[model samples]
Target: MEQTQGMADETRHPMTGNRLDAEAEASGPGFETHDYDVVVIGAGGAGLRAAIAAHDAGARVAIVCKSLLGKAHTVMAEGGAAAAMGNLWPDDNWKVHFRDTMRGGKMLNNWRMAQVHAQEAPDRVLELEEWGALFDRTPDGLISQRDFGGHRYARLAHVGDRTGLEMIRTLQQRAVALGIDVFMEFTVTELCKADDRIVGAVGYWRETGRFVVFNAPSVVLATGGIGRSFQVTSNSWEYTGDGHALAMRAGASLINMEFVQFHPTGMVWPMSVRGLLVTESVRGDGGILKNSDGERFMFNYIPDFFKAETADSVEEADGWYEDKKNNRRPPELLPRDEVARAINSEVKAGRGTEHGGVYLDIASRRDPEFIRRRLPSMYHQFKELAGVDITQEAMEIGPTCHYVMGGVEVDPDTQQSSVDGLYAAGEVSGGMHGSNRLGGNSLSDLLVFGRRAGECAAENAAKHSNERAAVPDSTATAAADAALAPFAEEGGENPYTIQKDLQDVMHRLVGIIRKREELVTSLTELEELKARAEHLSVEGNRQYNPGWHLAIDLANMLIVSECVATAALEREESRGGHTREDFPMASDEWAQINLVLTYDGESVGLARQPLPVMPDDLKELFD
Candidate 1:
């Protein structure tokens, strides 16, 4: 590969641009350098939104992603974005949406964030439409809304279950139109800081394995989640806790690390595709869950907390779908944490299907055309992947590792991290979803916070324009050496073997349900895995090597796995995603606390912080 030099432009100071190229050359031979006001990592919905916002704020921005520009994990979202648009129901508004989100998260959410998200989400969705996104519409030619779990009314703005694809398309097109630079297929391994502030980042090109450095004052992390740490997951391979681990290593804190949501409806049959997601739209549009004995078992699992708003019998539950104004919601539309635990209990009681899952039946409940029109992705996903025609047969569904409700701790107003120049948004930022995220909230969260992070970062960059931070030669050299270490070792353990073992450990010991002994054992096992990952060996040279890529990603997985297991052991209560079998009830004491994790150069440390109290004005909405 040929060496690439930093570009000189009006936005870049001449002395600073020359210093960056000289430092890149000193780091190693053929090192590529780029200079920008802000560098946004992970080109998903949040990253793209952040880049566009920064550019609109008069800052030169660049986006770096691990995959192709449009192939982010956001494209796999099958449900719609949640916003209180009130298009289908006049009574629906931001206050009702805020109440539903807080209750769905079991009141553990940051009050200001939930408020901001609910108020801003509707506008963000409208902004996407203005940028050329065509959504499914109602008879009145308004954007149609659909029902989702834990929502009060028809609140999701969808494009026939392919809403994520539409969102990414709209954001990517808008960013490209503004001429923001994009670096594709680049994996950032380390964040370089100067005087305890973010200065730049060091990474390598996935295709040619050459080193590249982005010298920017501000860095925004939008890398998605930590789902890949488990064995069975709906997340793609890129969701390896990269943002979480990077923030911690760069002296930032993570909160609520124990709350990993196991979405209740993933494909269960066809072992090759066990963790593939079955969108909740199947139920939102009138599907039902049944056990092997043909019993609607969700009715048996309704907790006292939600009993006032949930139907008690089959007749009322069925009637609620058509007459939502007069009847309570169906038990199947309960929050995801409640539904997932119900499925686990049924399976353990021998009421599960032949493939160890329950039946999600829409064929017997709705017309065939309705099923196809509302859930086209699911209809084809089953037909092609598992040979099951969802339109005519009940789909086998079970809980799978989905989103993590914990990540880099940031200020609610600015999206800035504890570190001076670091910012986080979307799923990578914590305190937005609290313990468990409701269906359809993830996409809206991306837009609302992604824009805030971008605007704040651009302002910070402008304030420090004359004092551009330089990446030290020693720091750049160390990052390059770490990438090369796997090939230098002979007769070491294979990176693939270590990764599989790590996944098994996380799934079995730190899964949806937890016990004190299992969590303790998981911590011990994670320490062993960490030691093994340090000595991982890959066979081929670095050019397009999958093994080397996995080797680099294992370090991040191990770090985040430890955070999950450690926090799960400490929170002795059952609430949302962090369920404890030993302490099966939600504790008042635990509800007031949030677990926070920080990493020094050597080890991860855990501490407790008080949950933010909602003001009396916002608290009255729940009443």
Candidate 2:
């Protein structure tokens, strides 16, 4: 937690003193204006990391978020952060982590970013340790490691099952202590740009119906994933693709929007907690998936895809985990995509439980103390939320939309978007996750690239601050008008209904499985939804009006959803998360290029481009 002069003696804007006065309120409360050297548009793990890095680089930084400081969706991340900790497998190294990440993404990850993540993740976790994060410690009083899906070794150093909470708390405390200006409940509706260069952004205060403008040389979009587009998701309400929409509408290209990762285990019963996550660490700690017939069905699904590593028998698989050097069958270590597909298959075959979910049983598989020791949060979540004692009965679980592997396109090294002066990191930026993101890699990606984007943005800001700042007035006005339009319209469409239809269309057509016809229908429906959004009406004054606000957010969700459906329609093959039933096989042609998405108001257009290949020496490095 190093502090720089940029962080010292920071001033806070008094909310009441600078609020809407009578004159400003006459014109619907003119937007509150402020300036910063760098503005980070999310308070999640990535945004926090970016702010920290910018502050460290001697740049004035502020974080604007839709939620309270510590309550971002990152708090719900039960699975641990991935780093080659080597607590369970000493032979594991960065090279192995890189290989696993690339393979997990089906080789669609940017090689350079993947390499950097693998190489730097361990040090980032250690830094967190120094910052007072109390991860579960081993017998030697060192941070303990746990196994997770997709990683070959015990690479996830967690605090039982509350790793995300620990990480966010650690970063949030550091940022607050360093005097980072945090504007909670401020939802950024648009990015302000001047002749193709990013200048700043305009957002509204959620508590009071006040518009606010942040004029900054550099803007970082780290607004996390877009999971709210689905009816059932593992993300919080704030993951509404606001960052993606802001960047795209400001002319930044979004890559890989079609690739969404559906985590294998979410509690499916009692519909209230439908998308609540059941961490993958349970399986890593020796839990097993069983059908209604009470059989370990993972063996049946382990074929050519993971034949080399999967166990042939129960004893072999269990033994392999005990001694990684000699044994072969790493049963619980299968890739997430394969496991998710297997669960879907089992449920489709009438082996599902009462809630169309299969049983995730850990009761008979491991001792109660061991399960309690490693997955304390998992037990508590089930017991508190669902009222099921995991030590007694099997938990009902199904797939839930967990992460979006698509976001603003960025250079592999610099983390700069296609548009200059604009940068992105974390789940809001693409190319690192490719088609499907492995479970624990997102936390690492946030730190690795968030730091890089911050450094790049800070350097660029330093270069430009002395020059006359050109805040885009028209852009700012346009965004502010659009954001406030919903409040002015008369009865036309219900936002909640529109959102439901959009979610239904996405879930039914563009969900876990895809077909060309289904995707085309999804696109058409989304276009209709966009039309409705244009004239959507609300019956409220803007203060804390969720209907009007969501009406605005619905536009972003629809746009990003269209990007996903269109990109998925264009891919024409099954690889990682984007599975097309029409073209059920992965192709070399699709592998050779990445889908690029550009949006027009009426529709989104797609283009194909070759992935930037790493240097020949770097190719050998990946191998």
**Candidate No. with top TM-score:** 1
The number of the candidate with the highest lDDT is 1
Give the alpha carbon lDDT tens digit for every residue of 28-105 in model 2. Answer: 646567779899999988899899999999999989988778988888887788998787778989988988888788
Across 111-196, the per-residue lDDT of candidate 1 in tens digits comes to 89999999999999999999999999999999999999989888999999899999999999999899898888889999999998
Name the runs in model 1 displaced over 4 angstroms: 1-29, 309-327
By TM-score, how accurate is candidate 2? 0.94
Model 2, C-alpha of 244: deviation from truth (Å): 0.8
Cα deviation of 114, candidate 2, in Å:
0.3
